[model samples]
Target chain A: MTATDRQATGATWLRRNRQVVAPVLFLLPGLLFFLVYVLLPVAQSVQISFFRWDGLGEPDYVGLANYRELAGDRAFEVSVINNVKWLLLYLLAIPGGLFIALFLNQTVTGIRLYKSLFFFPFVISQVVVGLVFTWFYDPTFGLLNAILGAVGLGPVNVLGDPALATYGIIVAGLWPQVAYCMILYLTGLNAVDPEQVEAARLDGAKGWRMLWYVILPQLRPATFIAFVVTIIGALRSFDLISVMTNGGPFGSTRVLSFYMFEKALGEYGFRMGYGAAIAVVLFLIMLVFIAYFLWSMWRQERGA
Target chain B: MKTAWTTTAALALLAALPATAQDESLSGTLTIFSDMSNPAPRAVMEDMAARFDEMHPDLEVELTIIEREAYKTQIRNFLTANPPDVANWYAANRMRPYIEAGLFEDVSDLWAEPEIAENLASTKSALTVDDKQWGVPYTYYQWGVFYRADIYEEHGLEEPADWEGLKSNCQTLLDAGTKCFAIGTKFLWTAGGWFDYINMRTNGYDFHMQLTNGQVPWTDERVRTTFANWRELIDMGAFIDNHQSYSWQEALPFMVNGDAAAYLMGNFAVAPMREAGLTDDQLGFYQFPLIDPDLPMAEDAPTDTFHIPSGAENKEAARAFLRFVVSPENQTLINGGDALGQLPVNAASEVDEDKFLEEGFEMLSANAPGGIAQFFDRDAPAEMASVAMEGFQEFMVFPDNLDDILGRLEQARQRIY
Candidate 1:
């Protein structure tokens, strides 16, 4: 609050600005690209939901009609319910990944290679993942059936059965998601504050409580990132659904995004307006979590 | 340093110039986009491209094959920016939308070139929209019941001639502990084939025309009766369980193994089954068992056609390509592929005596009935086809709800225009 502090702060700002301004100019291209590609399309997609048009034709204003249809659409309702199931179940990957990461975090021979090998599923394309799982779930020639036969159980049509089809796809989706979370946790574990762990060990703190009190708190940022990515992955799920079942068995496995695509461009119809309406609902559901995350980040920034 | 640099530069320029010069010719580049990735189709297309280059000696043809399921979205995107000069497209309803958009070139002039128009008569109907032909016909296939001759022989049965015969045959097959029919409705289009044939047989030609044109109500008793017939087969436990997960190709093994008696599929299925080791003598072809013998028979076959895009850089070359495709020599090569199982669209184009195609030719050629029932999905717009096919699947599974399903289709019909 003093005149000397103000003068010193002013001097500091001027000196920093002289150095920072050039870097800011250098940063402009990437920032502009991010705004254009990411931010602008999102805004436009929200705006487009109010109108009706096939991609080729002129769009007509149809306030709330698309939304009204979406609300009444039994398929959309089913899809939204499936998406909720995906979001809830997808979080299991974090703990599963954390355990795998911790198990492999030690400095053993070829451990670095082991960690990379563990992350292989994450590196493979989702299409390939979907194909692999589809084969695994194939009622006749799949690994699941072969194993079940050995156990004297009958063959179960996993993907063909409407009730089990979504779960089958979800299991396939989880394979890569778990690998992704493992990588995040491995990186987080590398930065875990070994000095505090050693200090706590000297005080006879060894197991879950010691880890919870000291090591876990330090892994918050990594856990937060993992949680956010997993949630987003669940919400944005489409490729596996498209590849595996294609929302078959009487459209049992349709998630919201795929349902939106079906509404718009699928053989079903080019109900682009209705698709946009479904998309807007998905976006709003996502917005609640995004807003909470943003608010949390903003509070942290303010506190810092 | 300057002398050494100049010598190296001269050598590099000399090395590159011939290749660059060779690249700058019309005969040097040929690009294709297609959605036929079945191994046979892919091999056939590539071989044709290589052969074309060999004949031209200058133009290099590059072929790109995409999976069928992804073709529509990929084609839509490609057309938005740089449409490929040539691509595979369906004959009727699918082509009509793109043609209306001026996305396809009117190859009517090419059609007039005597060699083509006279050759591909059956397919020309599918390719032409509003009196202008948009594409050249490559292949047209007949849809019917492909049965196991051996199985029928073992069970003391013959190819069904009418509804009663079909029902009796089903009972005979079921009593033998063999699945009566092997159907895979996973794509939903397979069921459309069943619907198209059944409706064609049940209501005859005029009724089908009226139903497809959206002039007649789907809930009309004629259509309901078709559902009733389909439900009888379903209730008898004749179809394979989990039929929804199996593609037509995947279901062939069941028929070949005697797990099923017959497959209601297009003629194209024969090649794959033959490749899988079934012989000409083992397979039997039949008209879909007639729902009503007195109601005249109509062929429910589909044609595959090719159209040039509107903005093709080489217009004359594109026309020449169309003319070449429809040429008698080329149509014969196309039919000769054998794996294609299609009758050449042109009358003069000879059948290869490839057993299955011969059978298709005989069955398809007979009867002074109406025009071909262009595969249901192709005859109907894509949106309506998907809805109706799904409705058909539901009706097959839940026959009592025919009224509700048809009523729903009536609502969907209202939205098309």
Candidate 2:
């Protein structure tokens, strides 16, 4: 009686598990594609960092020689420092965007259109943004210079001056980033609990105190997304640098991403080995921040 | 289950495909990776391709006209992977690394053909890397000062013969409210042109040779003197500011609209000028004024060439195309047009009665004292070229720091060699 009952139970278990089995079968195809295209290439790039190879021909095995040389490269050092500058300055966009979002949050005829119009720069390619800013910075016949002349202030060489060029490019980069942050804030603001704001006001909370106590805490998710994107965008600053300056005026605008490109592919001779070395170094540095972010997310998840 | 079976079937089909994709025959399609994307050259090559197809009906020539900047990256990638049957490159040092790596086919045999040999006599050495001819010379343009005729007339200026005269002409043009010169150094090559001319005039041919060859130190007095002349031009307000922000093509409008009186540029600028609505009556070309008049003229012209990649699929077709490109008939077709604006590399190509061609022809035949390659940047190794240009730009911006810049260039040269 017991054996027969056990057999009947096993048959029922197999029938019920068909639903799970079918879903797993469907998931396999997509998971394989994701593994092949995305995960594999990333793994390969990391693996490649350990060897010295040009884009052409076979790669030779090198034991951390590329990393050793990168340590001594002054240009590499400059690129890392510039990357830090880009990261810090780029975060300014989130606050700036939030401020703009709050200002334009009201409904006053065509407000939706205004929001979309303000978001325009984010949609266009960064290459186009770089070109527009390059023209804007042109010392002669540029809008900036024309304005300077009108005010009787002598012209300032924004791009040509090494001290100002990186900052100038960062400002151009921020134009679109701010728009992105603004949209995130606007979405977060829409979801803010209205009853809580009313309660805070009843207790005399207003302006900065009100924002700090109630509004800011509610915007955490949006700010978190904004901070992550801005940091990634700042670290991966290549297209704009390539288009605007090609790391020119003596490599003054070179960030790590652009420097990696120059080392690997640009006219500086195909030092793919040297370039991979640079990439590995860049990856390790990026890993530090990424690891910290992962830890933070894990703690948040545990708390939730 | 259905999707898995489909994927497996697709993979099986792909794996079963033949290795070679082309049809079985001597006359299959041949692809060309070319940077001559301008409509004029595209049309000329298309016509030639059609003609070649007619002669060899079985074989087809497929020409891909890529943009200049993209083409550089594309060609490098192509050469590394599935290289096109034929491709274009710069002669001299630009082709050196490719030649050294054995990436290009040695086409010395093609040069032995009488017509090809005779035609490339002037630029044969450039195409000949390490005593082996790796490519065929196609088109070349002479570079110098191109100015607005109307502005020069209005300012009572004639084409200057010496450095001082050129300086005075610039001053007069500036005082008259027209920008004396329009330059776009944003691409970095334009600044190299200024350095080349200054060095060519002051140091003459031999030093120019030594400088590019890395036989002379970049901090040498001759090199410093050249920078000093360039600095003088900058301080005098003889050149426009923000030259680094615009490309040469973007800056052409200044000269076209009479905003700038002159452009120190290659003969290619003439075509762009015409495109910008400036007529021959409004535009004129002159040799860069010499600091020492008696110094021998060494040409600063750059030549365009083509090479067959080592791993090219159609080696025979590639050779045939190279031969046809430098053949007198095809050379005439390329050089006879108003668009190309250059002397034919092939000697036998008749200069058609085209007026535009006449100006370029006269410039090449008369002004060339001896054929000199462009500048140190093009002639030197790519690494050295990058550093040297950085030094040149720095010196232009901060002339008082000449010692520091020259010292840097010297160190860079040492690092390169």
**Per-residue alpha-carbon lDDT of candidate 1 for residues B73-154, written as tens digits (9 for 90 to 100):** 7776676577766778888787777787678888888877766666666677778789998888677888888888998998
**Whole-model alpha-carbon lDDT for candidate 1:** 0.79
Residues A153-222, candidate 1: write the lDDT tens digits: 9999888877888888888888999999999988998898889999999989977988689878998888
> Which digits, one per residue and each the tens of the lDDT, describe model 2 over residues B1-417?
999867655554453343212222235677888888787777766776666555554577888888876777677788878788889888888888777667899989988988678777888887877788999888877778888888898878999989999989988887888888898766677878888788888888778878888899977877878887888888987767666656788788788888899998877777778878988888887878778777876667788888899888888888777877787777877776554657677777766564445665676667767556755567877777876776676666667878977886787677567
Docking class for candidate 1: acceptable
Q: List runs of model 1 lying over 4 Å from the truth.
A: A1-20, A60-63, A102-118, A149-154, A190-215, A265-273, B1-71, B77-87, B105-120, B312-320, B338-341, B394-407
In candidate 2, list every pair of residues with a backbone clash. Answer: none
Worst 10 residues of 1 chain B by lDDT: B18-27
Once superposed on the true structure, which residue ranges of model 2 sit more than 4 Å away at CA?
Answer: A1-54, A57-65, A267-269, B1-29, B352-359, B374-377
